[model samples]
Target chain A: MDLSTLTYIVVGATFLLYIGIAIWARAGSTGEFYVAGKGVHPVANGMATAADWMSAASFISMAGLIAFNGYGASVFLMGWTGGYVLLAMLLAPYLRKFGKFTVPEFIGERFYSKGARLVAVICLILASVTYVIGQMKGIGVAFSRFLETSYEQGLFIGMGIVFIYAVLGGMKGITYTQIAQYIVLIFAYTIPAVFISLNITGNPLPQLGLIGTMADGSGISMMDKLDMVVTDLGFKEYSTQLMGSKLNMFVYTVSLMIGTAGLPHVIIRFFTVPKVADARSSAAWALVFIAILYTTAPAVGSMARLNLMNTIQTGPVGEATANLEYAKAPQWFYNWEKTGLLKYEDKNGDGRIQYYNDKNPEMAAKAEAFGWKGNEMTKVDRDIMVLANPEIAGLPNWVIAIVVAGGLAAALSTAAGLLLAIASAVSHDVIKGMINPDISEKGELMASRLSMVGAIALAGYFGLHPPGFAAGTVAIAFGLAASSIFPVLMMGIFNKGMNRQGAIAGMIAGISVTMFYVFQEKGILFIPGTAEILQWEGYTKSWFMGISVNAFGAIGALVNFIVAIVVSKMTAPPPQHIQDLVEDIRVPKGAGAASAH
Target chain B: MDNNASKYWQANVRLVSILLVIWFVVSYGFGIILAEPLNAIKIGGVGLGFWFAQNGSIYVFLGLCFYYASQMNKLDKQFGVSED
Candidate 1:
């Protein structure tokens, strides 16, 4: 079958499977909608959590980021994965023992203040809405490429599919569908990787293939070869290049780790499992599952870089036939060009595609010596590395089709998870918990569904425009969560003396400082023309003490800890009942069965 | 809190501290802070630091999670607080 038809069939089949799961696991009550009736198996919940955590950013964008950024991108891998350790150890089990339906509920009950809960809800919404926008953008990109539709139309279709399962089945439906999605996405991601690995290095595992010798009669290892090839073209060495300063990388990693631990969508997944032990083991299981993809990512990235460089440079630089003829470019090159993500302009009227760091003065001198006016491949979107990998390696059409399905699965699964978190925070925390304490379960369920639709519409709108925000806003989301939600949640669990005033004060202070830094750097609320100051010319410089806005969360978190501690010391201690509640959450025993409501 | 519950909680905290220390050492210590010095040592075809940053630390994190779960469960059993 043709590539387009195959993509449609594979994507259509996955969508139908998700709809089927939604029907099978249709939520019957508010309990089911909110927490899947708290009966999910540890392994099943782990799979769902993996699906929830590995959004479009992880599946679609991360490898490409690594492919281009080289060693600097390791912050994403370590930061994202390490945060799960913090979650499993510090947060998930205690939250499960508390047996709450949402994160805000825990804050509300623990701080003994409706005000604290309301602040938490706002933080959760802000972090999650920004997060969902990225996922929506990922969905649109996947759809636009595979379905051959405009980005806006693709986003609408994605929203329609998510609306069906998420609105009907709630967490219950999303959980099972996510399990299916995890299977589809992992298989789709690994199969092409394996094929490409064998093609490149004769190693079946991409992980080993990354460090293995090339199969092309080159005695040198793949990493060494890649380093040589790119550097020969004036790019930095892949393995040894530092990403920003060591301190910045340290702070960025910390922000992402804490951010991952605090994302409400991930934290709430633990609530779906049957026991506190399940929550603990499920977090482990989730990381185990996520690690499968995370470990394979570096291999895919380095190998894809090697393939792209080889495709363009066909031979050693300075040689007459070093560049690939523009007229005879490979099928994968043409395929991506049709999407306008890969473009070639012959500035020197040359017929060959010159791919190099034209910005490098030394390389520019060499190009000038060769009578080349400039780099001819005008644009190569980094996102195409994974999507175009199979085609680059000439894999079967069916494999290419699976990749499209996998990308969609990744985007949709994460979008549904984030949307559910946003909806539940509004309906459960805001509406039922506050506005309508006397609201019926049926009414709460209706409110949840309505909120899901509204959240989807809002996310879709942002996805269309994608504000002048950098692609790395995934880190920004983590920074917000780490600064605002994580510190307060930790205090609620670990420090029983934490009072309402301190908790609220900490949240506001943390979120405000983090947002202020981010907005000041990116723009006010990321509006294009609203940036108070512009980025430094020639080089990206840190705003405060060599710390980029992306890494400001650690400082914000520290500020929160100090402010909360000082305020708590000055004010009255938490009530005895609140203190008792804290003690109750620490022990694993008598984690009462999740209430049906 | 009962003596047994207090003891169990203490054990949990101790175990978490140890594991988190390891977590910090591998990702932040070896991967970032000490990355330059560690890059002198090669593991397979990659630097030890890069390997930890991309691969080794993630594996350790997964192990830490399971290890913590098992240890905490044992502590729960010792305190006679294992869920029925």
Candidate 2:
């Protein structure tokens, strides 16, 4: 079938699937709204968590970051996947055993103070709201690409779909729809990767192909080739560290792991399963689901790099000489050209467009030797690599359509889960738990829907505005999550002595310091002179002592633990029975032992 | 409330400590500090460090989760805390 038709069919079918699930599994009460009634199977919950965890950033941008950054970006793969270890071992099962609907509830009960819970709700909202903006932006990109609508129109359609599914299904509907989405996204991600890998390295696996020999019979390794491309183009060697020291990498990785563990949407998935064992096992299952994409991503990056480089060096597959003219570029080039991800400019008046960095003295000499002026590919958006892979490699249009739908699936699935987390925290934790204790189950559910509507609208507004950098902004969201909420939750679970005062203090300190650093660098939120305020030499490489502000979670969590301990000693500990409750949560069978207070 | 519950808690803490040590080592240790030394060796087409950053740690993470879950299940049983 034609590309346009296929795009509609795939997107239409996925939309129908979500609406069907929403209608079939509409949430019934506050219980269903919060925890999917604690009845989701381990496998089902795992799929949902995977879908929730693998946001538009993961689906749309991670591979692109990896492809461009090469070995340096491996921090994302390790930090994100390794975070599940923290979740499974330190958090998930106990949180399930605690049997609470929200992270803030645990804080309220653990610290024996409403103040701590309120602080938690605030942190969760900040982290989630920033994170949701990335998803909305992704949705707009996908819709505009596939539905052939303007980005603003796409944002509206995406929001409408999310509003229907999220407000109606709550966790119940999202669980099943996410499972379907996981399948769509994984298939969409892998098929093109497999094809590209086979074409490039004579290997079907991208992971192996990453380090595999070059098909060109050149003595240089694949990494060496990548190094050549960027260095030739006024960039650093692909494998060589362009920025950040070892310590920063450590802090950054820890931050991502803790942030992943701290994220409310993912944490709430543990509450959906039936038992403590299921919660524990479900984290394993979630990792397995996540690994499908995580494992393949680097492979995708490596293979896509190889494909792109080869395309520039030679004319498509089986051709010898380089094709410099705009007319001779493949259909994929033209297709992606419409998205503004790929473009060329003829410099030096050479018929062939030289794409190497003009600033690189060595590569400049090579280009001069070849009678070329300078680099010609002006704007190559990295994110397009995964989304536009099929078209690039001469794959079918249906495959390209599948990718569009897949990107949307990735964005929507994560957005729904995040919006739901935001809503539940607002309604169940703040409104019901704090602002109005006597709020009815029905009223709380209504509040949840209203909050969902509000959150979706806010996300849409940001999508229209869009932060300056997509991947970097998404990293900030992770940094916020890592630095703020994860640490508070960890202290709540492990340290009986941590009090409300300490938790609140730690969260504020950790989140604020991290945000200050990032804002100082980005100058975002219309803050004037943010750049001059926090000036440090080697700031790009050093990024707050070479710790990606994303590592703020470990720093935040550590500070929370230390501050909580110190403050608890200075003040009084949580009530005695709260310690008993901590003991109760430690054991697995205690899952059913504690009733919702 | 009883000895069994205390015993289960101790055992759980011990298991968590061990698993967490491995988790930290894989993610922070080999993948970060020792990554250069590890990268001296190659896997597929990438360095060992890069491989861990990309694929190996994730597999180990999977193993760690299941290991923790199974160990916790046994602890639950030992303390007569099993829901089953």
lDDT of the candidates, in the order given: 0.89, 0.79
What would the per-residue lDDT of candidate 2 be over residues A31-129, giving only the tens digit for each residue? Answer: 787788888989889988999999888887889988887777878898889889889888998899889888888877887778878888888888888
- Model 2 regions lying over 4 Å from their true place: A214-235, A240-243, A315-323, A467-471, A524-543, A548-553, A593-596
Per-prediction fnat:
0.77, 0.82
Candidate 1 per-residue C-alpha lDDT over A1-597 given as tens digits, one digit per residue, 9 for 90 to 100: 898999999999999999999899899889899999999999999999999999988888889989998899999899889999999999999999999799999999899889999999988998898888888888888888888988889999899989999999999999999999999999999999999999999999988887788898968878889999999988899997777788888988888889999999999999999899999999999998899999999999999999999999999897878889988998888888988999989887768888898999999999889878888888989889999999999899999999989988898999999999999999999999999999888888999999998998888888877777746577778888999899999999889899998999998898888887777767787887665464445434465778888888888888888889899999999999998888889998899877733
Top-lDDT structure, candidate number: 1
**Best model number under TM-score:** 1
lDDT of 1 by residue, B1-84 (tens): 778777887888899899999999999999888887887888877788888998989988988999999998988888888876
Docking class of 2: medium
Which window of 10 residues has the lowest lDDT sum in candidate 2 chain A?
A315-324
- Evaluated at residue A418, the lDDT of candidate 1 is 93
Relative to the unseen true structure, what is the C-alpha lDDT of residue A336 in candidate 2, on a scale of 0 to 100?
79
